[model samples]
Target: MTDDADSGADASATDGSGADADGDRLDVGFVPAEVPGAGLTGAVETSALLVEHLSRRHDLTVYVASQHAADDVDLPAEDRVEYVIHDDLPKLPHPITAKHRALREETDALESHDLVHSYSSVFVPVLADLSTPTISTLNSYVAVCPKGDMRYHGKRTCSGPGPAKCVACVGVTGARRRQGLENEARSAYSSLGKLPLVRDSMARRNGVDAYHALSPHLAEDYAALDFPAERTRVIPHFYDGGFRRDPRTTAGDPVTLLYVGGLREFKGVQVLVRGLAELRSRGVDARLRVAGAGPYGDRIKRLVGELGLADAVAWHGYVDHDDLPDLYAGADAFVYPGLIDEPFGRVLLEALAAGTPVVASDVGSTDYIVGDAGERFESGDERALADAVERLVADYEERAGAIPDQLARFEPETVLAQFDELYRDVATGRLRRESRPSSASSPTPSR
Candidate 1:
């Protein structure tokens, strides 16, 4: 880390203007999937954490997709984190305009900021042009997976890198998405249906100074995307309510296996349900508490009813972020049986921070999130998932073993320090990225 004097000197060199005599100004934009103050979404959690943590040290400008007062969200007009909202965005069929708007905003912000940091891959296209340093934290598979689904054709895993099978698979959907885009100029109105979603993959590869992967293994996964390994940094997810240092150990029977994340198919909601049923048949006496709502909300409800798990499980449609603590406290074990590459499992961190033991499918950052503190199963394998959950629920040592020591590593001070390192690197052009250990599962091989 640069001392106050050296950091100030670097700032002076970058800002040429005379106003900053000491060069302490570190202008940074924390670009999120949406603005921090916006309504509840995964992006909001990350944005809030960053704003609350980074603002204590740097001048942060939070750039959002759009700032409109729908009946959904409210933003404070003034706060430590500044907001720049653009109302117009491209709809799903075409995101060209949206992409351009995002890029334009980054360019303008670069005039003031020393560097730009984003929490998602979608922001790369916008910030790539700036000579200002750039960094990103991959929250999901969107960086290498175009649909962000990690699942091809909705059922199987995607192969051969992003945009390769992505284009063909999208075309097979019969939306004629590619042709309309490729031949748009031929049409009188112009058909933009075929524009490549990964248009700036090359830029992200060459332009970004650093890309933060929350897990060590995931940093390697991006190699196929052409991102150099030297530029990839591994940092663990920063969970809320850290430093309290209470060891959360499950002491009672009827162990509750909880799953909290988007209630989508790829999240392995279906697999979880089946696994829970299998566990019950084996007499584990576990109750499942499934929270969060999404596109699969209705389908999940139907599956619960059909499987007759309505009595054994409590489905809290969508819990507010504030309610997360109580949910974590109430459960004996947290479970995530995702079928896709999850990139980094934030919920697993939240669970561990709550002192709740975790059991999740092994994919993406799942194992890294739990480390030795939790259990892992083969992705999409319901029987394997059931076995893992059963072990955690039935054994005391299994539930408490890693939960104590592993939980400490996620302390706010630790994570905030990591962010501090990234910030300093941007300000001084000296990024000494830590080769972080995998925090997801056990030291044991998952699978």
Candidate 2:
């Protein structure tokens, strides 16, 4: 809403309200849609990493809003950060609205902060309306797409949201097919969910004084959605420190391929299984290891059995975050065949960082993230996915060697610096919404 940063004034020259005149310590509030450990969703993971990074920086006092139980997420032990849990808060269908309402109730506590940063766009209005400046990060397509996946009729990637398309894609037809009890209650629940989503969607569309896009593609998408291009900054998500593991050599034989996320249909678990079957049919020595479970877990397992992949696939449902590095390093390649427009593929970055090559679908931010470090196939193409894995199997050393350089871009400091500066800028009303990298051209993925 403010373009004061266009004057090139430094955030250091604060008015003593947020950061002190010395620009030493900054009191900030972090309001995530959901805290980590509520499931391994990307928002939760990013929040966890932010807490870890900000806590160690003594210059910042972090206040994290907890929608889940206090003990649910074992936050880092640091005096700089505190998890403010509101157990009695109503569990509204919309997380942004819920957190906003909860925080509004604690106006005194929220107002104490120098700046309030909300990862969910819907909460931006709540904070921006207050005296403190606000920064909202668009981690998903919720602000632009009603169903939030940016899928057209649940078949393929969509350009943007429209009422006619939405009627067929979301309201009536559904982006995903309902199964089991969903079949009986789909209509009723869909109606209930739509009401809150409409309200939340409207709130997200406006009042975003500052916005962070987790990927370049998402930033471009948001820009197309009428978000201020200059104010929309592209800051990719970062993993917590200690994600590095011992160097992993290529597997001698029976190469392992890993999938470490939700098992939902849009996640392309079914496509991954089909690709694995294709790999086996082609006589490639590959094993598929799936970690993390979701509502589609049973369906995925059944598909594995049906495809005669029961022996080839191991379902390690819901692996712990700490244990992920070992899995990433031990594998020869990580497979991501996501069909939906993912905002940012953190798992893909984890695979590259662990010195394991990746064979991912060329969709969403995968192109911007993996670059030439990992192999890519057309999204949802099982045959192409199978071929891509085989290519990695043949050129393992060449691809894995790029890990160090690829990993550097997302290193904590590199990514966190962008955030640190943004925090100060937003707090001091010095963030010009138009200061963004050119969107006219797509940057080539580095070698």
Candidate 3:
């Protein structure tokens, strides 16, 4: 990390305008969905890292909604960053509208900043008309898919969101019912996607100076929904440098395969269990370590018993973040068997950083993120998953050796440099919003 003096000197050199003289340094507003800290979800963790890195070179103010705000005891002590909490925003009737109001109110104070960066999809529309240049990070499917998981009818990956299809999917599937909302309330909230105000706001293609996609596949996904392709930037989430561990010199006796994610059905823990059964059937010696807890725990445990792999599977629900590096280093390979079009698997970065080979489904950007460092199979295919794991076990050393190269692609310094350059370009009017071509064709869905 560069000291303030060095950062200011570098900024002065880049701007070539003596803008690093304290008063002229860029002022940035960072609006993340939740209060960023360690042990939170990957998106929040990414926000925390960005706060630490960006604050070194610019003045940053983090905006947080009341409901999502938390004490900053765990946050870094960055002198150049401040936190502003907006309280008592609308909640009932229309949540998206509430988000817009809250974000707009908070960002109104940041209008004088050089640029505003939002990490929440709910606030994208509100940023559209802001006089300030804005960049939003597309972290999830909330902007297009009402259910936000990007799954059609809770089965296959959604091609893209259409008003009628999204409304029907939310009403019939009632996906938010899992959140403990009643049927009527869930329908009322989700069906808002059909309204012109809501639909048009979400489908708006321009206004923000840039959009950041965590992967190239994600950029393609959003382009299908008419997001401006010229303004979309693909940048992957970087791993925590402190999480690195030495590659395992010896494999576990039974070839331990690790999975660290929620036990939800969409997470495909059942498929991993079934794959473990398939592996046993083929006399491939392996054991599985399942971490994380969710509503699907009962079903997953029952499936393990039914498959007669009770002893071969171990459950360590909700492992702490600090212990994850050691866990990854102990395993021969880490498996991500998600069934949906995951935007990006942050776990893949964790596995690669620890020098563990990844065996993930070919869903979303899993193949792209894992690259040549891991094995991938057709999503939700138990037999194929087993085959991928078998292949990794056959050549674990070679796959593990490739991890360093893949891991370097997402190093904090490398990724932060991209953001720094982009921030400068956008702030200086060097990168302006480009008109998306009318004749552009939507890319085929990867799922």
lDDT of 2 by residue, 235-320 (tens): 98764444565445565589888999986777888898999899899998789999987767888888888998888988788888
Candidate 2: minimum summed lDDT over ten consecutive residues — where?
1-10
Return the TM-score for candidate 2, rounded to 2 decimals. 0.84
Flag the better candidate by lDDT, 1 or 3. Answer: 3
CA error at residue 287 for candidate 2, angstroms: 1.1
- TM-score to native of every candidate shown: 0.79, 0.84, 0.86
Candidate 2 ranges beyond 4 A from true positions: 1-22, 36-40, 58-67, 92-97, 159-168, 171-176, 183-206, 432-447
Cα lDDT tens digits for candidate 1, 1-447: 222322433344346522233345478877766656564666566666667656655677877664343235554334666777655565544554464455564454554677778877766555555556778776666555555655555556665444446655544432322224333233212122322435555444556677887787667667665676777777776666631224455545787888898865567788888888888888778788988876666767778788788998888878877778778878888888887776677788878767777888887777667887778899878789888876675564656667767766765556665766776776677752333122232122211
lDDT of 3 by residue, 190-293 (tens): 55632544365465658678888999988998888788888888888877765677666456679899999987778999899999999999988899999899
- In lDDT terms, how accurate is model 2? 0.68
